[model samples]
Target: INEDSYGVDDEEEFHELDMTGRVIANNYRIESKLGAGSFGQVYLCEHVRTHEQWAMKIESHAMNNNPQLSIE
Candidate 1:
């Protein structure tokens, strides 16, 4: 599926981090972006060993400076 299928536009100004194809926490491999908003982006990820998929919500650091809103 293309970006249009996910309602994402290439011309939009987004602050979400692009983590697709990257491994997180040394286990979860990021697959694709599911959705994004003013807060952050959600990604479809998979467990490298078990192949279990999960949705991970990651906040955009460029949006705000409040420490409470950060996932890191």
Candidate 2:
């Protein structure tokens, strides 16, 4: 059976901590969780000024512990 990945790339995966309702870099505010994976998690954030929504990926410490990890 042939499976389609919808152009998804595992090498481009992201990981991050959940920062719900928290502001970062004095620019954007984390809102909610979008998804997660073995490496990290993704969150939904918004711009403080324009209120534009964005998807952010955060790599976890465990992922960084491994030298083979993709995220630096």
Error of 1 at 63 (Å): 5.9
Lowest lDDT 10-mer window, candidate 1? 1-10
Clashing pairs in 1: none
Off by over 4 Å in 2: 1-18, 65-72
Candidate lDDT scores, in order, read 0.68, 0.64
Q: What lDDT does candidate 1 reach at residue 62?
A: 48
For candidate 2, the TM-score is 0.62
Per-residue CA lDDT of candidate 1, range 1-72, in tens? 112213333324344347689787788899999998766788999999999999987655444566766454
Cα lDDT of model 2 by residue, 1-72, tens digit: 011221334534323233588776787788999888776667789999999999876655445567756443
